[model samples]
Target: MNNYNHILAKSVENGATTLESHLESVADFAVVAARYAGMDTEVALQGALLHDIGKASVVFQKRLRSKPSPLELPFRHEIASLFFLKLVSPDLQPFMIDMIVAHHKSIYKDVSGTGIIDLENEYEEDILQFHLSDFSLWASEAIGILAELKFPGVTHETVITEEDAREAYYFALDHCRKRQKGWSQWKGLLMGADHIASAVGDFKEKVPALFADPDVSFYNRKGELYPLSLIDSDGTKKHTFVKAPTGAGKTDFLIKRCRGRIFYTLPFQASINAMYERILHDLGDHVEDIRLLHSISQLLIGEERITEKVIQDKFGASIKVLTPHQLASIAFGIRGYESVLFDLQGCDIILDEIHTYSDIMQAIVLKMIEVLNHVGCRIHVGTATIPSALEKEILEILGKEQVQYVQLSDEVLTLFNRHEIYKAEAFTDLLPVLQQAVEQEKKILIVCNRVANAQVIFEQIEELYPKTKKMLIHSRFKRGDRNRLEKELKNEYNVSPYACIVVATQVVEVSLDISFDLMITETAPIDALIQRFGRINRKRTAETIGKYKPIYIIAPPQKDPDCLPYNPKILRDSFKVLPDGGELLRETELQSLINQVYPKVEMLNIDLDAVFVDGKWRLKELWHLPKSALIEKLDIDSVVCITQEDDESGKYREADKEERILMEIPVRYSSLRWKRLKQLDIGAHPFVVPDIAYSSERGLDLAKTGAENYDTNYQIW
Candidate 1:
C-alpha cells in the first residue's frame, strides 16, 4: 500500500497538465468498455489505472528534457503499461500484455512509400534504439503507485532487470505483429482479461435514461411511424427506400427509432454539424446525450469537458454521430475506436445518406454494420437515392433479404413543392444580380467550387456593397470563427434587410441548419447541386419567401467545341468500375450525359483496379495504381514545402481566403498526394543530382541513384 501511494503521488507530481486528467478519463471509459464486452469490472479498472505507468520510464523523461532530444517522445503508453505489468508480475500471462500492446494498432499501410519525407534522417543508424529497461521504470513506478493506493491484488515480485525487460519487449513486438495479421487466441485471452479489469470502472454500471425518453418518435420525411415491428417479422428485410429529397425531415424520423444510444454516420462534416444542431433544437433536453464523434467535432464543439467521471458513465443509451473516417477508425480497430464498442451495445444507429460512400468505403461500412448488429445494434439508414451495390452489401452483411424500409408517400410529395433550376452562362457580373436582391433585403448564399474562387467572389461582393452586411465561411477558417459566424447567421444577422451576402464553399452543403432566401452556385456534381437546392425554401413557410427568389447555377463558358455537361472520362471510368457495368444508370439521366461527355474526356475506357471480389474488396498492393496513373496522366503534382514555416513571397503569398496555405499549389490533385508524403518535416529539401555533381551537405541528390531530382516544374507522375 505504501509503494502504491508513492507511485500515485509521483504521477500526480510529474504529470503534465492534461496527463492525469486523460488517465482518469481513460480509466473510467475502460470500465464501460469492459462491461459492454462482458468482462468483470475490478480487473478492468485496475488495468486502466495502470495503463500509463510507463510514463515513468527514462524515455519519457528524455522527452521532457530541456534540449530537443534525438529520441522520439511519448512512447506507446500501451507498451509502457504492458512492460510495467510484466515487471511486477513476472509470471503474468502473455495474453494480458498483448492487449495493452495491440490497443492502438495502425491500420493503413503506406502504399505511396513516401510517408512524410524523412529529410531529417529520423531512422538513421546513429539514433539509439529504445531499450526495454527504459520501459520497465515506468512499469515499476506504476506498481509502486498501486501499492501506495492500497488497491487489492496490487503486489510486486522480484525487481526487474535488463534481461527481463529485453525479453518482454521482444515478446510484445512479436505479439503486436501477429495481431496485425489477425487476432490470435492469445489476443482473445488478453482482451478477455482486459475486459474484466475494465468492468470495475463506473462506465460499466448504469445505462443512461435519456435514450428511453417517450418524446422521441421514429418517423420518415412524412411524419409517418417507422415499421418498428419489422425487426421480429419473418418476411424478408425489405431495404428501406427513401424517396424523400434533402431537408424533408429525414433526420427527425431517424432520431425516433434510435431510442437507445445512437451512432449516426454522416457523409461529411457539414452534415454532422447540421444533424447535431438539428438534434439540439428539436430535443434540446437531450443535448448532453449527443456525442459529436468526428475529427472536426473533437476539435471544435463541446464545452462540458470530457472528464473521468463523464467517461465512467456507460454509453448504453446516448448519441454518437460521426463522419465515415471516425467510424472507419472503429471498424479498423484503432485505439479510440474501442470506445465505440462500449457505446454500441444495445444502441440504435442512423446511417444517413447511405449511397454517398465509395465502394471500398461501403464495404467497410457494411462490415461495421454486421459487427454492430451481431453485438445487438439496430440501425436505420436513409438516403436520397439507394444504389444497388450499397443495398446488396448491407443486406448481405446483415444476413437479411430485406430491412425495414419505409418509402415516401404521394401525400408527402404534395407537401414538398418542386424546385426550379436556372442555368446562367456567366456569373462574372453576379454583383448586379445580387445587388438587386440586397436592395430587396433578401438573404443570399453564394457558393463556389473552390476556396480561392469563394474568396474572389466574396471580395467582389464586399466591394460592390461595402456598407452592406456580409460574411465568408469555409473549412479553412479557424473552427471558432466558423462557429461564431454560424451563431450570427442563425439569429438573422446574415439574412436581415441589412445583411446582404454570405459567400461560402462546399462546407455549406450538409449539416448546416441555416436557410437562405436565394443561392448562387457554381456547377458541380449532380448530387452536390441537389444538396445546394435543398438550402433554399426548406421549411415551406407560407410567406412564399423562397418562391420570390430564383436559385441560379453559374455555369462555366461552353467549351470551344461545345463539350458535354459532365466530365466524360470521369463518368466512363466510374461506369467500368461499377458492378452492373452501365446498367446501374437506368434510374437517372446519367447514361445520356455519359454518352455526351465521353467524347471530350480523356481515358474514358481505362479500367479501374479491381478492388472487390466475392462480396468484398480485398486489400492488395496494385489496387491503387490506376488512380495514381490518372493523377499522373493529368499532370497534377501537389505543391510541397520543405521548410517548417512557409515563405510568403511571390506565388506563395498569403491569399485572402480562409484556411489557405501560403504555398499555392497550381495543380488540381495536390491534396490527394499530400496525404501520401510521409515523414515530412521542416528540413532542407533534398535535391537529386547525378553522381558527378553530388554534394554531401546541400541535401539528398536522388539523381545519383538514377532517381530524378525533385523539381517543382517536373510532372509527378
Candidate 2:
C-alpha cells in the first residue's frame, strides 16, 4: 500500500528496523567503506541495497513476531534474498550475489547447516518450494520497497513471478558454488555495511565517524616522568616499538605515534576494561568516539553498562580497546575475517604489554603482524621486558627498517626503581610477612597461578584476619560478580585508605591501574613477574618518586600437573632469577633477565592449520572455515554454565542477551567430565549447575562443579 511498513530486517526488543531503512543505512555505510578500501562505491551501494530484500517475506516477519514461520525448518533469509538477484545488472550480478549469498554465512557448509548448498543437498523435497511459499505476495512487497528506494531495474511496473524467483535463486547458487582461488572484497564490503547498519541504529549520524582521526595532542603534553610524551612521534617509519617500565606513559606514547584510526589491544579483558576507562578520561569525555570490544565488555559496571547498551557499533570508533582473541580470526581466516581486515586496513594497531603472552599467543601475534603489515596497518608494539628472540621475530615480520624503535637509557630506567624483592619457599612461608603488612595497615595483593590456588589463599587470609577487608577474583566467576569485583578493586579498594587485601589470579597481571603497598605472588614466567611487581609501588609521581615497596615471590610447585598453564622449566628459571634478601629490582636489567629465562623462542608453526599462510589466503569461494577453526586451534574450548536458581526462576529466559550473559559462569571445557548434564538452549547453551557450586563471595566452586553427582531430571522445567 502506501508504504511496506511490515518488511523488517533487524529485530530489536520493542521495535523492528524496516527493510527500506536498513537497506538505505547499509548502502550509505557500504559506499563509505568502499571509498576507504578503494573499491567501486556504486557497486558496494547496490549490493547493500539488495542484501536484505529477502527479509520482506511474510515468513521472516512471522518469525520476528515469534509466531510460527510459514517457510520450512532451518529457513535462511539470505537464500531467499537471492531470489531478487535479477534487480542487479547482469554484468555485476556475480558481485551482487557475492554480497548477499554468504553475507550472513557461507554458501556451503555453514555451521547452522542452512546454507543454500547445504539445504539443496540435505532436503528430499524440492527446498525451493518452501522458500517460494507465497513468494508472489512477498515479491510484491519486496518490489514496493525497491521501487521506493529507486533501485535500478525495478519500478512500480516491474513484476516477478514465483518461477522467476526460483530461476534467480538457482543462478545465484550456481555462481557462488563455483570455486575461485582468491577471496571476494565485495562480500567483505557488504558484511561490514550490514553489521554497521544493524548495530548502530543512527546510521546517518555515525557513518561520518568511521575511521576517525582523533586528537592525540593531550598525550603529547610534556612532563618530567613521562619522557615518551616529549619525544617527536613524526617520522618516515610507519611502525613503532617501545620498551618502557609501567607508569612511564607507554599508553600515551603509543597513541601519539598513530597515523590513522587506532585499534589498541591488551592481552587480557580486565586490562582492556581499565584502558577503556582511562582512555575515555584522557580523551576528555568523548564517549562516542571510542569503543571497547571483548567477550565480557557488556558486563562492564555502572556507567560503562549504560553506555555499552546504547552503542553496539564495534567498528568506526576513533579508538577500540580489545584483546588479541577478537583479531585472531584474520590470521586464521575464519568467517567474517574479511570484514575485520577491511576495518583494520590502513589503521594503526597497538599491541600493548604483549611480552606476557605464551608461545602459542606469540605465534599468533607474529602471524598477525605479518598479515597486518600486508594490509597496510602500522603496528606499534609496547612492552617492558621483551626477549631478544621474540623481538627479532617481530622485527623480521614488520621489516626492521620500517619500524621506529625506542627504549629507555639505563640511567632513565634507574628512575623507575620502585620495588624491593623477597622470596619465600611457599605461600605458607609468607604468613608472617602478610601479618606484618596487615599490622602496618598496608594494602596487600596476593596473586596465584591458578584460580583454585587464589581461592585457597583467599580463605586462609579470611580465617587469619577476620576483621580485614578482603576479596578474591579469577576467570571462573559469573560475569555479574566479576564486574562487581573489578569495580570494587578499581574504585573502593584501590582508593581506600584503610589496610585491605585482595587475592587474585593472572587476571590482574596487565594494564590494570590499581596500586598496592605490598605483593605476595606465586612464581610465574619472568615477564609475568615483572607485570605483577608493577602492581606494587605503582603510584609513580614526582612526590612518590624513589618510594620502594615489597614484593614476595612464593617458590613454584615442583610437580608437572601442579605447574600447569606454564612450563615447569620456565617457572623454575623464573623463580631462580627472582631477587632474594631484599635486593632492589633494577628496571635496567629486565631484558637480560627475560632473555635468560626464555633463551629459545618456541614459535608455533600454524601454517598447516591457518587459512592465511605464506603470502595469501588459502580458502576460496567465500565458504566458512568451521567453528572448530577457533575452538580447535586455541584454548578457547571453554564453556559457560548457569546457576540452577537463575534458570528455574525464569530469570534467564526473561533477561535479554546481555543481561543473560551476566548470569552465566565460564569454565574450562575439560571441567565438564560427565556425559549427561542439564543444559539451557540459549546464550552459549550453558549447563545448569547446582546452587552449591557457586557463591557471590567466592567464585565457581571447582571441586563441587563436576556433573557426575548431579541428576538431569532435577533441572527439568
Candidate 3:
C-alpha cells in the first residue's frame, strides 16, 4: 500500500489525487447509493474501487508526468480496468464487468462487436508498455485497502497474471452480450457516485438525502377543501385521477395524494415555472427540497442561485416541477435515462393539465405513464377537461380497478359557470367589441391562434385606440422580456385591478393566475378553449358566480388550407356547440361539449403504439448503442436568444462560459427560420438581433425580416 502512493488518478492544481484516495471516495459514494436502492452494496463498492485502477499503469503515469501530456489519442483507462475482473467471485463477475466498462461509456457496441477495447483505438504497441515492476505492488495495495474496508473474499495475494488478465477481458465481453437488468442499475449507481464525488471534491462531505417525509401542513392550511379533497386518498396508495374544472383545488388534492418524494409534471415550460414558484411560496421553509427543471432552468432559478442547476442535475430534489419532455430520455433509452429512472423509482408523480398536448406529445406522455408505473411510481393525473374517449383509454391502460377515479359533483360544477359565449366573424368583428370593453374600463384578454396573427391584431388595436394601455405577449419574446411581462401582468392586472388590453397567443392558456373581465380568442380545440376560458372569471366566488363575462369566439380563418395549431374539424365542431347570442356558458356542460368534439380516441389521430414499440426496441438494443449515437438521434435543434441588456451587462457574456443565461424561445420557429435569421447577422453580435426587431413594449417582432430577424430564432423545444 505504501509503494502504491506514487500512482496518480488525476492531477490537480494543488497536487495529484492518488489512485487509492480517488478509488476509496468513489467506492464510499457508490455503496451509499446502492444500499439506498436495496442493491448489493459490496458488489457496487468493488466495481467503483476497480473502475480507475488502470490509471496505475506506468504509461499513463508517464503521460501524466509530461510537462504537457504529449499523448495525442484519448487514454482508454476504462478498458485497462477490465484486466482485473478475475479477482471477483465468478457470480459477481458480470456485475463488476458491466459497472466498470459502462461507467463512462456503453459496454456493448454492436451485435457482432468483439470487445470494449475495439471501441477505442489507443492500443498501439508503444502505449501498451506497463510498469510491470509496479503492477504487483499496486495490485497488492488495492487488495489490502479493500480488505481494510471490510470487503469479503478478496485479499492482498489476489494476483493478476497476463494469462488471468486475458481471460478476465474475454469474460467481460461475453457478459456484456446478456444485457442484464441488474447491470443497468449497477452501472447507473457507479456513474452517479463518481459524478457526485468529483463535483463535491470529496465523498466524505454529507450528500443531501434524495427523499424526505416532510409535513405537508403548509399546503393543507392554505388549501380550500374541494369535493375531490374530501374523497379518501389515504388507503392503499393507488393511482388517482381527478376530473375537475380549473380553480377547484385540484393541485392541492394531487399533492395530498402523494405518499413519497414527488415529481410534479406539466405540459408546458411556462406552466412548470408557475407551479415551481407556487410550491416554493407555499413551502418556503422547505425551499431546498423543491427544484425547477426545464431548458431555461438556470434563468428561471435566478442568476444569483445558478448553483442550484448543478445540484438539481446531480442529486435531484425531493420535489421537482418539470415538463414531461425532461423525462422523454427514459422512453428513448437515451444516455442519462438510467439516472432519471433511478430518481423516479417509488416516487409519487402528478401530471397536471394533461389534455393540452399534441398527438405525438400525448403518445410520448402515454408511454411515459406506462414506464413510470412499471418503475413503481404512484401516478396522480389532474385535468380540467379530457374527452370521455381519452379518459377511457387512460383508465384501460392503468387497469380501471387499480385507479381511484374522482370527479367534481354536478352541483359544484354549476357554481363555476361564469362565461357568456358569443360568435364573431373575425378579428375585425371583435374590434368593436374590444373598443366597448375599453370604453367601459374593463380588463380585457385577447388570444390569437398564431404569433403572426397576434401581431397583426395587436397593431390594429394599437392604431385604433392610441390612448389605451395595452400589452402584447407571445412565445417569440426573449426569455428576459417574457419574465418581466409575466411579473407585470401579475402585479398590474391582478393586484391593483387596472383597465388594460392584453393581446396574446395560446401562451395564456395554462397555469397563469391572472383573471380578466373579458376575453376574445380565435377558435381552437375544445380543451384549449376551456383552458382559455379559465383565464377569464377565474375566481368562482359569490360576487362573480352568476355574472357572465363575455368570451367572444372568432370563426376560423376562411381561406387558410390548414387550421393548424388546431384541427379544422375540431374547431368547426367547437364553434357549432358555442352558446349563441352571449348565452351563459355553464361549466357543467363543458365535458359534454368535449365529448361531442372528441367522440372517440381516434379523433385525436395520435399513434399511441409507436412510442411504446420504439421504446421496447431500444430497450432490447440498450447495451449495444453508444450514448453519443443515442443523443444524436434525440437532438432537437434550438438556439439561445440574449437581449441587448443581458449582453451588455455581462450577466451572460462575462460570466463563466458555462454559467451564461439561456432564454429558450418557443418551438414554432422551424430550422428554416433559423437559417434565414443566421444569414442576416448584423455584426454587433453574431446572433444578437438588430435594435429595430425587439422592443420592450411589443416583444420580438415576428414581422421583421432580413437584418431585423438576426437573433430572433432562439426557440427551444
Candidate 4:
C-alpha cells in the first residue's frame, strides 16, 4: 500500500486521511476565520495545529483499529493533548487550552463527569500519569510532526515528565476557574474552523465569503402602495421599530434599512422559508451568499440541497433567514453558542413579527435582545400588531434614544381598511357564507388554532366541497409533505383561476406570503388575529387599496383551560376590543385595540437559569453549560418523529440529511408520552409513529394515534 493509502498507519482524520494534512487543513480554516473575526491569526494557527496532536499516540492508533489498548485508568485525548503545552507560548497557552480542552468536552461539569477538572480533583498525580502513560515512546513522534511545520514554539527532543503534565493541567484549570464574564472568540474560532474542517475536507476551498455586506438596493424601488418604502429609512438612530399593517411593506423597508450583513429572524419555519426564497430571488443575483438557517432548510427549500451536515451557522453569510429557536443557544449558553454569538456580533438583525410565544418565551426573546445588544448588533423590529406595553419594554431595552420609531400616517393606515369583520358563534356558523364564497368561485382560507382543529375542519370542508380544490397545512407535517403543502398553498391553489380553500393553523399568521378572497379564522390574541387578517385582501395595489373583503372571526373559547398557549383574559379582551357584526376592521384602530388587549408586558424572572441577567453575563468565559441544563430551564418539549410508512431508520443513521429530513416530523414530546412508539437512537431520539396517524392532505391525525405498528401493505418501501 502507498503511504497516503496506508490505512493501518492512520490514527487521526477518523482513520481515513493523514494526520499532517488534517492539522494543516484546520490551521488554514482557523487562520482565515480569525482574520475575519479580527483576532490574532498566529495564535489561531498554533491552536488548530496542536489541538489534535494527541492522536499520534500508539494507544490511540490501536484503539482506532479496535485493538485492546486499555490503560490502567480511563483516557481522554483532550487530556493527553495537554501534555505538549510546552510547544505553545506562555502568553498564548491560555487561548490554546480553551480551544483544545473543551472543544469536545466541557471544561468543568461534563455530562459524563470526566472533564479535565473533574479528574484533576479525583486523582491529581494519577490522572497526569495516566495521560503521560508511555508518553516517552510517542512524544518524539508527535514532536517530529510539529517540528516539520517549523512553527514558532515547536521545541525539539522534549522530555516532559508527569510533573510537567500536572502543571499544565492546573494551569488550564486556574485560567478557566478565575475567568471573567465574556465569551471567548478564540474558542469559538477554533470550534467553527474544526467543525468546518471535519464536515468539508478542503476548508479553504469550501468556506464561503466572510463578513461581506449584501446589497439590498432591490428593495429600494418606491411604490405608491407600499407606504413605508416612501418614508425615510436613513436616520441618525442606531436601531429601528416599525409597526404597520402587514401589506404596508415592513419586510422591504426593514431590509433596505440594514447597513451591515443581515440576520433576518422570523417566528416560524414556514415564514423563514418564504422570506428566504423571496430574498434569494431578489438578491441572489447580486449576493454570493444568502442562507436560510434551519435543520432541514437545504433539502426542502433550496436548489443547492446540502446532503452532508456541515456547520452552516458560521459567520459571513450576507444574509441569513432563521427563527428565534436557532438563536436560543446564545441566550442560555447551550452547546455551539459561542460560535453563534461570534456570528451575530456587529450584524444588522431584523426581528420580524416578534409578538408570539408564551410568557416564558417572551422572556427568552427579551434575553436574546439583551445578548444581541451586548454583542453590538443593531436590532430592528417590524410588526403589524404590537401592544403599547410590549413596545415600551422593547424600547427600554434597545434604549428610547437609539430607536427610530416609524408608524404609517393616518391617511395611509386608512387606505389599508380592507377587512370587514363579522362575528360567528362557531365554525358551523360560517358554512352558509363559505358555501356562497366557493359557489361564487372565490379563493377562501380557514384558520384554526390547533392541528387537530385544522384537520377536523379540513376533513369536513373536503367532504362538503368535493368539487372544489382544497388543502390543509399546519406545524405537524413531515418535511417533504410540508414542503409540498407550502408550494401548493403558494403556487397551485393560490394562483389557479379556479376557486380553492386552504384550511390551516396558526402557521399562516405571520410572514407566510399568501392571499385569499375571504377568511374565517378562530379567535387568538389581538396581535395574532391582526396578523391573520392580513392574509385576506392582502394584495394591496392601487386597485386593491379601496376594495374591501370580508373576514368572519369565531368567538374566543369560553373556558380558560381550553384557551391554552394563549392568555384567556387576553383572548377575551382581544375579541371584545374588535369591531364586530360586519363592521369594517379599520387598520387605523389596530394599535389601540392591541393595547387594550395587552395592557402590560408580563415580565418573568429567568435569571436563575439564564446566561444574561440584569445586563450581566452569568456564564463565565471558557465554559458553557450542558444542553441538558438549558433544556431543563427552558422547559422545551418539542420533539421530532417519523411516520412508520416513511421510516428510513437505516438511512437516517447514515447521515443522509436529504432523505432523513423527508422522513422526520416535528411533534411535541409531551404529545407522545405513555404512547406505544418506536424510538431511533439519534439526536432528540426521534419517535416512529404508525402509518395510520398521518395524511399527506391534513398532516398527522392525533385521533388515529394508537399502539399499532406499521402494516407491510402501507409501508412506502
Candidate 5:
C-alpha cells in the first residue's frame, strides 16, 4: 500500500493528474493484470509506465493546453504516444500499441460507438503513413526527454524502423477496426484499475445502503392490481376498469399492487407533486423508500445525489414517481433509459391518469407500455375516465386476455352525484356565471385551454369579483409562486370561512386536492373535461353551501364560419347525444358517452430509417436542410430545474428555467445549491461515457448543473 501510494504520488507530482491522467492510471492497471497473467511483471510495469510517457510529449501536450496556438491545428494525441512507446519498450510494444490506438472512441473502427469493445481496430495503409511521419517524430522526442530527465529505463539504440513501425501501426489500426467494441482490451484493463483505485479508500468508510427492495404489498398473485373499494372482488388479469370517482381513494387502490419498485406516472406536474406528497405523508418513516422522479421533484431533491450512475452503482430508491415525459424518454431510448430500465425492471408501475396523454404522446406511451411489459414489469392503469379507444390500445398492447378493468359501481356513482351542464355562445357570458358562483359563496375552479385565454378570463373575473377573494394559477408562473397559491388554497383549516376562487389554465386539471363548488371550463378533449370534473366537488360527501352547483362547460361559438371548432366535430356530435340539465351519475352512461367520442386516430409515422439511411437524416427531402443542422435544432429548453437556489442569484427561488443541450448547461458545485435545480439528468453526466455535459470551449463542464438563460428578446417561432 505504501509503495502504491508513493507511485501514485510520484505520477501526480510529475503532472500526470489532468485529463491525460486517466491514460497513465489505466497503463498501471494493465501492468497489474499482466502480472496476474504471469507474463513478466517487471517488464510489463516498465512498458506500461512508459507507454503513456509519449503522452507527456510536447506534441500531445500542446493539444491539451488551456489555450492552443491559433495557427496550430489540433494534432491527434494517440499518434505521438504510439511512436514513443514502440521505440522505448519493444517487449511491451503490443500492450502499449493497443492502449494508444483505441483510447479515443472515434479511432476504434470496429467497436466505434458500440460503447464497449474488446480489441483494437488496425488498418494497414494508414499505419504505414502514420509510422513514417508521426512515429519518427514521437520516438526521437521521447528518447531525448528521457535522456535529459536521466530516466533509468533509457536505451541507446532505437529498436523502431520504418517497416517494423509500419506493421505495428497497421496491426493496432486493424485490431480496432475489427474489434467491434468501444474500448480496447488494454484500455479496459487500465480503466478498471483506475475505478478500483479511486474507490479503494472509500470502501473502508461506512456507506449508506443505497437500494431497497420493492414494497410488493400493493400487488397480488399472478401480477394484477387489486380494484378500488367500489369493486366487490380484486382485479384480475383482464382490461380492468377502475372508475371510482375523485376522492374515492383510487391512489390507494393502485398503490396496493405497485408494492415493489413502484413507478407512479402522472399526467400533470401538479398531480405528480400531489402523489409525491401523499406517498411522503402516508409512508411516514418509509417515505425515503419512494423517490419523486419528475423534473420538478428532481429539482427539489436535486442535491440528494441520486443519479443513474449512483443508482446503478448504489441502489437508490424502491419507488420513483415521474411524469409522462420521463417515462417517454425510456421508449425514445434516450440517455437515462438504461439506468431507468435497470432500476424500474420487474417493478410494479402505476400509470395514473393515463387519459391525459395527447394523441402523439399516447402513441409513445403505448410503445413504452409494450417495452416495459416485455421487461417483466406489472402495470396498473389508474384513471377516473378511460375512453374505449385508449383502453383498447392499452388492452391490445397489454393483451386483452391478460388485462382486467375495474370501474366504479353504479351505487358509488349515484352517491357521488354533482355538477350541472351549461352552454354558452361566447366566453363573455362567463361574467353572469361568475356572479352566480360568488353570490352563492362557492369556490370556483375555472379551466381554460390556452394561457392567453385563461389570463383574459382571470382579468375579467378579478374586475367583477373585486370584493371577493380570488387567485389565479398557471404553468407560466414560477413553481414557487404556484406552490404559494396552492398553499393558500389548501388553507381550508383556517378559522374563518375562507372564500377564494382560482382561475387557471389546463394546469389545474390534475393533482390539485382542493374541491370547488363549481367549475367553468373551456371546450377541450373528453379526457381533459373529465379531469376538470375531478377538481370540482372532489371530496366524498362535501355538502355545498346551497345545492351542489352544476359545472358549466363553456362551449365555443355555435356558428364559427371563420374557424374550425376547437372541440372536434366528432366530439361535438358525442356531446349532442347526451341530454342537457340531467343527472349523469351512472358509470355505464358516462362510459357509453366517452366511448362514442375520442376514437383513436391513426398518426403519420416518421420514417426514421429514411432519415438515417446513411447515418444521417434525410433533411433535404423532409425539411430542406442538412442532417447536422436538423440534429442541432431540437428544442430541449422547456424543461426547468427546480433547485433550492438559482445558479446566478444564489437563493432558493422557486422558478422554472429552460433546459439546455449538455454543452450549454453547467453542473452545480455546491451540494445544497445543486439540489434546488430540476432536470439534472436531461443529458449525460460528464464522467460517464458519451459525456452529456460537454462544452466545446471548455471541453466538458462536469461541474455545471444550471440551465442557460434564454434570450427573452428573441422571438420563438
Candidate 6:
C-alpha cells in the first residue's frame, strides 16, 4: 500500500491522481451504494478497485503526462484491467470481470467475434507490445492496498504474464456469450461510484440522501375534499395501482405513496413541466431536491441559471419529474444506462397518465416495468382512465398478487361530474355557439386534432372577433416562446374574470391546471376525451357543480382514414358512447366508456421477442441498435429548426453549439421536411427554416408555398 502512492491514474495541468487514492475512493462509494441496493458489498468493492488498473501502463502514463498528447488513439484501460483477475478468487472472477469489461461500454460490442478483440492487422503488434511490460510492482501495490482496506477475497498477488492476459481476455468473451443475461446490479454500482468520484474529484462526498418525508401541508391547508387524502400513506410501500379522476388530488396521493426518492413520469413535455412546477410549489422548502429532466432540460431551466449543480441534479435529485422515455435507455441498454439503473434501484416511481401512449411505446414500457421490478423498485401507477384489457396486461406483467389495486368510490366520482356533452358537425357549425359564448363573456377553449386545423381555426376566429384576446399553442413553437405562452395562458386566462379564447392541440390534455367555461374538441379516444373534459368546470365547487359547462365534440374528418393519429374504431366507439343532448356526462361512467372503446389491447406488429429469449431478457442485440432507431420507433424526434432570424442574432452567434441546439424546438418533423431544410444554403446554420415558414404567432408553417421567392437572409431585428 505504501508503494501504491507512486503510481498515477490521471494527470492534469497542475497535479496527478494517484492510483491508490482513486481506487480507495471508488471502492468507498461503490460499497455504500451496494449496501443500499442490497448487493454483495465485497464484490462491488473488488470490481471498483480493479476498474482502472490498466491506466498504470507506461504508455498510458506517458500519454497522460504529455502537454499535447501525440497518441491518435486512446488506450483501452478496461481491457488492460483484465490482466490481473487471476489474483481474485475464482468465485468472484465472473462478477469482477462483468463489472470491469462492461462498465464503460457494452461488453457485447467490445468483445464479440467481430469487435475490438479481433484487432486489425496493423494494430495487433502495438496491442501485444503494450501488454508485455512488467506490471508486477503495480500489482503488488494494489494487492497490499486492498489487504489494508480489508477488501474480502483479494489477499493474493499474481504476476500477470502474457499468457495469463490472453486467457483472461478469452474468458471475458466466453462469459459475455454464455452467462450475461440482463444488466448486472454489480456493474451499475461500480459505474455509478466511479462517475461520482470522477465528477466530485473525491470519494469523500457522500451520495445525497433521498427525500423520504415530503411536506404535504399544502394539501392539508387547502381543506379541500379529495378522496386520495383519505388513504393511508403506509400503502405506498407496496406496488399499487390507483384509479381516480383528474384534479382529484392524484399528484398529492402519488407523492404520499413514495417512501424514498420519487420518480414521477408523465407522457408529454408540457405535462412534465407543469408537474415539475406543481411539485416545487407544493414541496416549498424542499424545492431544491426536485428536478426536471428531459432532452431540453437546460432550455427548461433557462440559459442563465444552468450551473454545474443544476446539471448534476439530473441524476441526483430526490424528486425527478420527467417523461418515461428517459428511462427507456435502461431497457435498451444504451450508453450510460448503468448510472440510470443505479439511480432507480429501490426508488419509488409513479407512472401518471399511463394510457396515453402508442402500442410500441406500451411494449417498451412493459419491458421497463419488468426490469424495474427485478431491480427492487416500488412501482405506483395512477391514471384517470384505463381499459380493462390494458389493466389486465399491466397486472399480469407485474404479477397480480404482487400489486394492490385501489379505485375511487362512486360517490366521489359523482362529485366530479361537471361536464354536459354535446355533439357538433364541424368547426363552422360551432361558430354561432362560440359567438354567443363570447357575448356572454365566457372563457372558451378549442382543441384541434392537428396543428394545421388549430391554425386555420385561430385565423377564422380572429377574423370573426377582431377585438377578442386569443392565443394559439401547439408542438411546433420554439421552446422559449412556447414556455412563455404557457405561463401567460395559465396566469392570464386562468385568473381573468372576462371572456377570452385559446386554441391548442392535444398538448392541453394532461397536466395543465387551467379551466374553461366551455370546451370544443375534435373526436378522440374515450380516455383522451375524458381528460379533455376535465379542463372545463375543473374546480367543481358548489356553485360550479350544478352549473355544468358544455363540451362539444366535433365529428371526425370525412376524408381522413380512420383518424390518422388515433385508431378509427376507437374514435367511432367513443362517439357512439357519448351522452345525448341535455344529458350530464358523469365522471363515474368514464371507466366503462373507456372499456367499451378499447375492449382489447391494441398490439402493433412490432417484434420484441428478440428482447426476451428463453424466458430470460437479453440486451445483447438491443445494446448494438442505434439510438435513432429507438427515437423513430417512439414516433418522436428532437429536431432543432433554426429560423432565418436566429442565424443573424448576436446572442445566437455567441452561444455555444450545445446552447444553440437547446434553443431549437423539439417537434416531430417528416423525413421530407428535414431533407428539404438540409438542402437549403443557410450559411453556418444548416437547420435554418425559411422566414415565411416560421413565426412566434404561427409556428412552423408546413404548408407555406413560394419559399423560393422569400428572402432567405431575413432577420428579426
TM-score of 5: 0.62
Question: Best lDDT goes to which candidate?
Answer: 2
lDDT of each: 0.47, 0.81, 0.69, 0.79, 0.50, 0.71
lDDT of 6 by residue, 1-717 (tens): 346665687787424778767888788778777776678887888888888877776656666777434454435677778877876788889888767875665544433322334442336556644554555544555456556556565554534566777777667656766654566666667777877666556314433443333444454433256777776655523787888987777877777766777889998877888887788777846545567776445555544334423334334467888888888876666666767877897788899878888777877777778778877888988898988888887787777676767788887788888888889888888888898999999999999888888999988988988898888998888777778788888889877788899999988989889888999999988888888887888875656655788899998766657387887877778888999685898877887778788878875533353344334666652133335365466667544666666665644566664556445655554622533443223223435566677778878766652235246453221
* Rank ordering of all candidates by TM-score, starting from the highest: 4, 2, 3, 6, 1, 5
Candidate 3 has its poorest 10 consecutive residues by lDDT at 677-686
| Candidates sorted by lDDT, best first | 2, 4, 6, 3, 5, 1
The true-versus-predicted C-alpha distance at residue 432 of model 4, in Å, is 0.6
List model 1 lDDT by residue over 340-424, tens digit each. Answer: 4545555766787765544355555666675566556676777655544445556665555346555555454444443555655
Candidate 2 overall lDDT versus native: 0.81
Local distance difference test, candidate 3? 0.69
Cα-lDDT of candidate 4: 0.79
Candidate 4: worst-modelled 10 consecutive residues by lDDT:
1-10
Candidate 6 positional error at 538, Å:
0.9
Better of 2 and 5 by lDDT: 2
Pairs with backbone N, CA or C atoms under 3 Å apart (clashes), candidate 3: none
TM-score of each: 0.63, 0.91, 0.83, 0.93, 0.62, 0.83
C-alpha RMSD by candidate, in order: 11.3, 3.2, 5.4, 3.2, 11.8, 5.3
Tens-place lDDT per residue, model 3, 1-717, is 334567787765434877777788888778777777789988988888888777766556676777534445445566567777877888988788767876666554533242364442334333333323355545555555555555566666556776666677667656665664431666677777777666555424444554554445555534232555556565664898998888887888888788777889987666777788888888757645677776456565655455555555564467888877778766656556666777777788899888788765676677778778777888998999998877777776677778878887788788777888999887777777887888788899999887778888888878987887788887677666677777677778655454688888877788888889899999998899999998898876656756778899998876556586677888899888878798988888888888999887563332332223422433532243333332233223244444444554545555543344433233333423553443213222224444456676676664553343334443321
Error of 3 at 268 (Å): 1.0
**Residue 483 error for model 6, in Å?**
1.7
**Residue-by-residue lDDT tens digits, candidate 5, 322-401:** 77666553454333333345455567778877777665566667766766776677878877777776777777777766
Q: List candidate 4 segments past 4 Å from native.
A: 1-17, 67-72, 148-150, 153-166, 202-204, 301-311, 628-637, 648-655, 682-684, 709-717
